[model samples]
Target: MITLDSASNNNTAMEELEELFIEELMDLLNGIPELTVIFSADESAAELKEYAEALQSDPVGKSRQIVAACRASGQRRADVKQIIVDGNRKFLWQPGGTLRVVQLLRDCETRWSSTYLMSDRLLELYPAVQCFLNHPQQTQIAHLLFTTPQYQLLHDIQTILAVPHAAQELLSAEKTPTLSAALPAFEILLESWIDLQTKLPMLSHYIGVGIVKIQEYAAKGRKTRAYALAMSIVILCGVTFIS
Candidate 1:
């Protein structure tokens, strides 16, 4: 359900924007280059007006200041990037397993990824955080959140359950019992991270709860359908035997 929109205002607007991908399970959206800001001009209008007036007076200075900040401390290409997502404005570290994928998500946006949890102010500042977890490559990682309804998370955890054991075999000093499998251990780490994040109440919501209930109903329906099919098969077999 997430769609990536273009943030470009003109021919020169696209740089990293071209890196966006719309893979099977991912949705991303871009915003206008500069005008997406949600300004609160209510009581603060006087000060806000003053600030804009200053910017208007010295637009070149404002540009230079931003450029200076980036050049002075540019870490955009690093494996780990910090970004504000929604209202929480959480500091970020790439999940160790998928740093490259993290970078892609960190710079992207998705409408369906639920940035509503983020405040407008935070979103305004870092519009790319919402889709960070939804990139196709990180889809499996995102499912690691217990609040998610999808089974891919558990499936992914199961996939990596033997990583520690594998690591043990690789170690020299008497590779004892392989420690543990690497994959599931990684899943455990992911689970812990996500669980800790949700506990922060500010980011907690009923979405996962609702998804779980939906899954339960779907499971029940499948079971009921299977039972009916089995009954129909038995009846047909008996009738054929009589013939």
Candidate 2:
């Protein structure tokens, strides 16, 4: 079985490979009747990445605005970084305290997780950000400052994306990784989004989009015999161990 990311080029390549496998390789593989080639996508990682990009690309999205404002100018970036450094010094001066200062992260288009990391860091240094924005010399960019409600929205975004992020990490683990974890991860993602929809009504649109994407991938995964067989093996192992 071959697993590929959900890229247009990868999709095209998979299709071509499938056609080749059926037309030319099938006859050759006929001697090995039990052997089969299965092509699977990196389910959770792709879905979560796409979901993050969607949030950032939405024209009306506050996430997009916040990111844009932060990245608007090099000077502004430097200022924010300086503020964080200064804040770290003060924090470390306190008795029995250690500095945990992190530079503000900028998101990259190629890696979706960067968006989450960026938001996480921005929220972490929010006080420094406010101080920078409210500075007398920084008045020109003062309009870029996020409101309390906007910051809260960003917090909500962080909370909502954490579920899928953890699932992606689990599926992509380097140690004793199993594809058998895929279905459970997807189910957890779907349930998490569904629950978030009710709890964060203001974010229903984003949550709805996430739910649909999860369902689509889950359905495609369920249709594959390998998925079912893997899940069955896990269940049987559990039952045997219990017995």
In order of appearance, the predictions have TM-scores of: 0.18, 0.59
Q: How high is the CA lDDT of each candidate model?
A: 0.29, 0.59
Error of 2 at 110 (Å): 2.3
lDDT by residue for model 2 (1-243), tens: 112232233323222322332334234334444432321244543443333343333312444455566567887777777776777777732443423455566655555455666677777666777777789986876776765544665677678767866776677677533567787778877788888889986456656766776788878998999877876787777732221
Positional deviation of residue 7's Cα in model 1 after best superposition, in angstroms:
27
Give the Å error, residue 10, model 1: 31
Candidate 2 minimal-lDDT segment of 10 residues: 1-10
TM-score quality measure for candidate 2: 0.59
Could you tell me which residue pairs clash in candidate 2?
Answer: none
Alpha-carbon RMSD, each predicted model: 20.1, 16.3
The Cα error of candidate 1 at residue 25, in Å, is 26
lDDT of 1: 0.29
Off by over 4 Å in 1: 1-200, 227-243
